[model samples]
Target: MKLRSKIYLYSSVLFAVLLVIMNLAIYYIFSTLSVDNQLDRADAEAAKIAADMRRAGSEVSAPELLRAYVPIEGMLRLYAGDGSGPAPVTSAAEGELSTLKPVFYNEKHSEIIRVDGRSYAFISIPVIWVDGSVMNVQMTQSLESTMDTLGVLRLVLAGTTVFALLPLLLSSRVLSGLIMRPIVQMTATMREIKQSGKFRRLTLDETSKDELVEMGQTFNEMIALLESNYVKQEKFVSDASHELRTPLTVIESYASLLKRRGLAHPELFTESVEAIHSEAIRMKELTEQLLLLAKHHEHWNLSMKVIDLEELVRDSAKVFRNAYGREVTVKVKGEVKGYSDEAKLRQLLFIFLDNARKYSDDDIYVSLEASGQERLITVVDRGIGIPRDELPKIFDRFYRVDESRGRKQGGAGLGLSLAAEIAAAIGARLSMDSVEGAGTSVSITIAAGSGE
Candidate 1:
């Protein structure tokens, strides 16, 4: 069932139970009070009859006394201490008189008995005469009238309860709908988003301090982030596809040329083979770079340790100097110690140094400077520096300011992207300063007490 329906059902059931209890309680209390009042009236009537008999002082006959003391809407009977039958003062059935015999013998002061299928309240009083004889005065009042009144009350209560339930259920349903309206809207909005593949936020009532409002706000923020990530993912896929197509087309062309005419023209065979080899190498490098970019985007798995930043830079500079047969100057201003993933830091170093070597013919400078609460690691080279307008896009995947130069240097344009990702993953800031035709300087800032 829907939540609104369930709320209404449960609430109606509870209200129905309460109504039943209240009706039963009212009937019981009213019935008890009515019975008590009837008994009191019977006692008062019997007292008046006894008083009249005392005033007469045995001078009046039993029939005359009963006639004189007859009560309104009631029956009266008198019995002697002798074994004589009762004297009737008011008209009553013989069976009813017989039913009263047991009550008299039992000496009960008051009782309610059914006679001839009609209910009666009987009150018995004993009378003492001056002659030492005893007499019993019995009075009875019909309960049928009071019972009819109660029956009417019961019917009225039952009818009221039945009529009240319709409005109760309807009102409960309306209240439940009002309560669940926000959730219903949220569900519809989610369905629309799923169908259209669009990120749309929920318009909430800002004045309401309910949890549903908070949930709507949070959901809007989550969709915003997902949309941003989706846009970036689309761009990455487009760039990767464009980068892969050229090398693949070149390889396929060279392979086709070799297969068609290489055996006939031995001179053409060498050129075709070389072209195929070069293209294959390019494809291999592009594939590796794409895999690296994908891996860094997914999750960072760091093996953190403390290392001397100065020593690490010196080691990387030595490797660079040996590999390129060029001088790599290392300058340290202080003892730079940091806690970081050593392998990832080495990879970042390789990217910067390799980029410097590929672009610049001048000697490379790797510097580490420590100031208050921060350490700066910079790679400076006198290269064909990036244009100011192109610098912002340099860290974008497969973006190259000089595409031909990058191709000649075997650069897939992923080194700076990978470096930036690694720096972000390790909680460092990577920045660059370059002047076209003068030099380029790339620096990574490591906060003091970071990565520990």
Candidate 2:
């Protein structure tokens, strides 16, 4: 069955069963109390009749006394000690007792009995008779009054039980609607997303802190994350194609020239081959950078360990001096020990140094120090600094402030982007500041807790 129908059916059945059981319990208790009350009244009446008979011993005839003490629809019977004497002394009665013979008791006694398929309340006591002998008096009343009253009660209870279900079933429908409302809305939102080819989220009520609202919130977050990744993926592909097209066109042109003039024009053949090789190397570098940028930082398997920031800085500077013969000055302040992935940290430092080396001709300065709970490594260079407007876009892949200068510098504009990825992978913060005429300062901050 559909969820709504199943909800309605199960809820209604549960309420109905509970209501019937409650009514049955009420009926059972009430019937017991009613029958007991009837028996008590008959017992009390029997006591009063016996007292009167004893006080009037020999002063009145049995028939006359019985006539005055006759019950409404009950009986009063007197029997001698053994019940083998004269006939039973009984007043007018309503029900027959052909199947019952009750025993007499010394003190007052009361009981319920069944005779001729009808119920009765029987009370017996010993009393002094008109003959000055002890006699046994039996009083019995039919249970017709109790049965009639109980019959009325049964009808009322059954009616209440059945009628109570009307509101219960109605409330079940309302409850089902309340429960299924969010589910239906979510389905509709999904359908809209499918048809419109765009991600959609459920409208949420902030005040309601139920699971249904939490579900909608989770769905919205997931959709937002997916949309963000999708936009980034599309932009990455578009930029990659644009960047690759230029080098590919250069290589193709040079290849065509080599194919046409290589055997005849020796100098032209050498120039063409050189051009093709240069573009081919640039293409290879661009492809490698693109692959690095494509992988998210979270997927990189980092080998985290404690590294001496001071030593790492001096080592990087020494490598730069050997490779480019550019003098790099290194300074260490306070304790420079930090927990991080050493290889990724070194790569991040090298990207900033490369950028500084390209833009500046003066000596490059590197500082390693500890401030508060973080390890700060700053790289400063006296190069042709970046303009203030281009600082924000510096970390975007393939974004260059001056494309001509950037191409001549052998920079595909992805060094800082790769630096950013490395910094993220090692849980470090990368920031940069520069002026057009002045130099640029790049800093990497590794907080103490970042290692964990």
Candidate 3:
């Protein structure tokens, strides 16, 4: 789940729990107050009924007197003096009092009762007679209305709980998303930098004065420092390689002259001269490849314009044919026009053909086609295919699939790296799919409308 959703979920749950607790507490407090009020009212009514019973005369039947009593006159039930059974009662009858409390000065005056899930307060008052005797006058009051009110309150509380939490849930989601958006953008920018070795410019709104913006700024600074160091290092390597090439070429020429002068035996002279020449040629190729890579990396800029990729491939194929006749076969298919550097595209295409001639037999397939948003240019060679493990590293600088074999084949192993740099400069992607025994296929996919 996203961060926003998780925050909203957790906050909603917490608020719901708190709302329930608050509602329950309010219900308990209100219920207690209602019960207390009912008790006080019931006690006063009991005392009044007791006085009325005395005035009605002690000689009358207790049930009759209770009937005549006003306060306890209704909803009052009287029991026999001996506590044996209930006597005749009416709507005026009050429920039984479990204890003898009204006549005893030290006894409790009132008690609580429950009936049908409703609470009530019951009180007993002493009815004093002329003969120093007493009668119990009991009073009762129903808590039905209070219970109903409480039920309504419970519903209200539940509704209030949900209503209060809804905004918090929504706010949590919105706030979490707002907080993480900058971080997500920064993450995407860093990924682009890592993939292409290019720095991105990021702009954060002023209201977003959070830690994520600070982090983005820090990351931009780091990329700037890395780019500066990388440029300096590439320049140094290119300069050193170029400077060494001239002297090495002169040494090879002088060695060849020594052998031609017949100063040594024929076999020894030929072998020594050939070794010097081979080393010199290898050094020269290495220097050239390094210089090309340095040039592509130095500025991280490509002069792009609209170019016909099919025509560009055709021209490169003709150049290769003129240089090495009939050794490689080049085929073009479908119209592929995109924005790219014409010089760099030509160089990239030549690398494919060169690889084909170096490692494969006579048959090489070059095909260009457009699909969806991408234009794919593929170069397939029926040569000694790359191993599965080495294919991934083929585009790394100076990485050779067959290191020992590549040196003998007069390759410095920088062709694919240079091609990859060209592809990145044009916002194209390069991919190679190959199997151990199967011929390798290198595909370059440029945006349909991207180039020159």
Candidate 4:
């Protein structure tokens, strides 16, 4: 069943049970009081009759005494010895009198007896005469009026219960709806989103600080993250396909040419073989970079170690100078230390220096500076600097400001992206300052290591 229905059902059942119990208690108390009031009236009349008999002594007249002292609304009887006595003061029958015989013999004091299908309260008292003879006085009051009063009271209570139930049911339904409204809306919104495959958020009530509101906020945030990741994955796939297509097309074209005429012509054969080999190497490098990017996208476990930032920079510059015969210079302020993965830091430096060398024939400057709690390492190149708008996208995979230059220099446009990932993994910040023509400087700031 729905939550609203269940709530209404349970609440109604509870209210009904409470109503029954309360009404039953009230009925029982009222009935006891009414019965006691009747018995008290009967007892009072019997006492007056006894007092009158004691005052009259042996000459007391049972008929006259009963007539004078008995209540007008009830019956009174006198039994001088074996119940062979004057007729009762009221219109009660002999059968009704016989029912009271047990009260007289058993000393029951008082009891309620049913006569002619109507209820009556009976009271008995024994009196002793001056001659030592005993007499019994019996009085009875009809319960018809009391029963009628209680009947009316029960009707009133039942009516009140019914009246109370109308509002109770309505209020229960309304309150349950109010409580479940948020959950219903959430379910509906989710169903619509599932059908349309769209990212939608719940309309929250900011004024309410309820748990439902918090849940809605969390759900919206989760969907937003999912949407962002979904868009990024789509873009990544498109870019990877585009980047892979170029080298594959080159390789295919050269292979086709070699298949057609390179075997017959030895000169064309040498050129085609070299072209094919070069394109295959480019394809292999691109695949490797793609794999590395994927690995970094997953959980990257960094083997953190304390490494000299100054020493790492000098080593990278030396390798660049020796390998490419390019002019590279290093400047260090002091023995700057950093806590990070040494191998990843070296790879990051290589990415920056390689980009610098690819675009510039001038000398590249590598420098490390120590400041307070951070070590700043910079690779500066006086190359064709990136445009202001393109600088923001330099770390994006397969994005290059100088695409033709990048492809020509065997750069797959993943170097800066990889460098950014490594820097992030090592708790460093990678930033760039570039002008259109002056120069570009890539900087990495890492936490400074202790002297220990």
Candidate 5:
């Protein structure tokens, strides 16, 4: 069965069982106690009659005394043992009363008896008869009134049980609905997303803090993440195509030109060859960066260890300067240490230094220092700095400061974005401060080695 139905069925059954047990207990206790009360009242009346007979001391006539003390609706009798008696004294001589027979017994006692489908309670007490002989006074009272009262009680209890079930069923249905509402909404939202090919979220009730609300919030978070990844994927494909078109067109055109006129013109052949080669190399670099950018953060495999920041920076800069033949100034403010992946940190440095080299002709300054508990590395360049407004977007993948210059310089604008990823992977902070015309400086702050 569906969850709503199951909840309703199970709860109803449980309530029914509990209600039955409770009502049965009430009925049983009431019946037992009421019967005992009837017996107690009968015994009290028998004792009172015995006392009156003793007080009479044979002065009062037996028949007159019996008539005066007989119950309003029951029989009072005197039995002298051996089947002999003064006779039964009863208020009513007709119907069930005429059938009752009093018996003489040795001790005072009481009992309940049923006669002709009617219940009766009687108590027998040994007493001196007014004539000076030992006799038994038996008081018998009908249980009709108590039985009628019990009948009425049963009716009330049955009606109450039936009435109570209405509320139980109603509350169970309402509670089931409350529990299933979120799941139903979530299912509907999923259907909409599938049909429309877009992300959708549940409308939450923020006033309630429960597991259902938590489930809705988690679903919304998952949708948000999915939408973000989808947008990134689309942007990557579009930008890749845009970047590849220029180089592909150049290569295709140069090959077509070579086929048509390269044999007749040597300089035309050299120019076409140079242009094709340059575009091909730029295309290759762009493709490589695109592959690197496509990797998710969790998939990045980092080999972490304690490495001297000063040494890594010096070695990286030495390689950078030798390859590009650029003037690089290095400064060390004592020894700097950090826990990081050395190769990725070196790549991060290269991205900043290369950007500086592209925009400036003067010396690029690299500094390493220990500041409090953190190691700080900064690279400064006298380059044309970015506009302050564009700083936030600089690290976004495929974002560029100078689009035309970037194409000519063979930079795909993915360097800073990759640098950001690497810095995050190694638990470091990367930031840049720049003036529009003066220069740009990038810094990385990392905790000192805690060898884990």
Candidate 6:
């Protein structure tokens, strides 16, 4: 269900419950008040009848007739001591009147007396008679009028409850709609953003003063960051690809010359062929590394498993020793075990070892160790160390500390960048420490277990 409809339904039900409780309370209170008033009026009428009886000397005197009339009043009766002789005309049969007792003083009493198959309230008050015998005056009234008034009161209360609920229901719906409109609009806008692949600002009015405004502001900031990062990534890839094209073209041109000229010097041809093959290989490696880095940036899933880092470093050192004609030393200082992709981990170790060889003076120290709960792999080289200002840009694709020397050494400068990508993909931390003209130490730290 929509938020607005839910709010409306919940509020209306709550208001209706309160309304019903209030109406029921009022109905009960008014009904009690009406019943009490009827009884009080009945008591007053009975007292006046007794007073008139006291003033009259005779039982059938005219003074008794002076009693004030009461609404719903019925037959009046007079009783003497011993309770049975000379009863009034409206008195009951001898058997029924035998239940009456003598009234010696002014007192009030009541009973529900049934006669002729109907019920009546008999209100009796005591009075003093002239002959020293106590007499009682009685009057009976029907409860039909009070019951009728109670019935009408119930109808009025029900009518009031219904009328009150109408406005409550209407106001609840309006309030719910007003509160929920901004949220609904924000939801629609987010859906549009997902479908369109571009975020647009939420244009809710400033009059909305609640969490919705805060959410809109946060969404705007998030989109701004996404756009900025996307632009930076696009620029980086474009620049890296552009840099490779020139070297690739040179290699292609040399290959075409060799194919066309068909060995002019024989020895010279062999040298040219080697140069072309080396450049082609370098271009291929650079392109493949760049593509891998791009794929990593776009969220490549690297399957993680426990691998022996000590063995990986030892193997990488052997590869570099053969490839670069350098004396590489590998030391396994501790048990180096962590979760990572085996192939990618080997690729990363090779990148670091290759970079160390390309810059260092033939002696490279590669060590893998475990300390506490962390695995540390360090590649240290006593080479022409990077300058302080150039160290920060070393991880940038196609960046080099000594660009001329790097090109002379046949280096493309993407090895460290690829190493950094691999480190990030496997949840390891890669950092470097260096001193100019002395040496450089590159350290990669991987946590034990899954490296979270």
lDDT leader: 5
lDDT of 3 by residue, 5-57 (tens): 77677777877787788889998998889878878877877777667666655
- Report how far off residue 425 is in candidate 4 (Å): 2.1
What candidate 6 gets wrong by more than 4 Å, as runs, is: 1-210, 240-244, 255-276, 294-311, 331-343, 368-370, 387-414, 436-438, 448-452
Encode model 1's per-residue lDDT on 4-91: one tens digit a residue: 8888888889988998889889999998888778778778878787767766856877678777776555577776656553366654
Candidate 5, residues 155-211, lDDT tens digits: the string is: 999999999999999998998898889888988999999999988988998998999
What are the lDDT scores of the predictions, listed in order? 0.80, 0.82, 0.70, 0.80, 0.86, 0.73
Which ranges of candidate 2 are over 4 A from the true structure?
21-71, 74-93, 103-146, 203-218, 268-274, 292-299, 384-417, 448-452
Q: In terms of TM-score, how similar is model 1 to the real structure?
A: 0.63
lDDT at 146, model 2: 85
| TM-score of every prediction relative to native | 0.63, 0.78, 0.45, 0.66, 0.76, 0.59
List residue ranges in candidate 1 displaced over 4 A.
2-164, 175-210, 261-275, 296-301, 371-374, 384-394, 401-410, 433-439, 447-452
Query: Model 4: runs farther than 4 Å from truth?
Result: 1-165, 175-189, 201-218, 296-299, 450-452
Which window of ten consecutive residues has the lowest lDDT sum in model 3? 97-106
Writing each residue's lDDT as its tens digit, candidate 6 over 1-452 gives 97788899999999999999988998899877876676678778778766755665565553245233332335566665565434433323323432444342356687666565544567877666677766666766666577777789889989998999899999998889877766677678779879997766767567867776777777777768877787767777786776687677777787777777756646657767787778778888778877887683447667788887777777777777788789888888656687677787777777777777777775899887777778888889998888888888888777878778988887777788888888888888888988988989988888775552
Q: What is the Cα-based TM-score of model 3?
A: 0.45
Which stretch of 10 consecutive residues in model 4 shows the poorest summed lDDT? 99-108
Ranking by TM-score: 2, 5, 4, 1, 6, 3
The residue-level lDDT of candidate 2 at 390 comes to 85
Give the least accurate 10-residue stretch of model 1, judged by summed lDDT: 97-106
Clashes of each: 0, 3, 20, 0, 0, 0
RMSD of 1: 6.6
True-structure lDDT of candidate 6: 0.73
Model 6 scores worst on lDDT over the 10 consecutive residues at 89-98
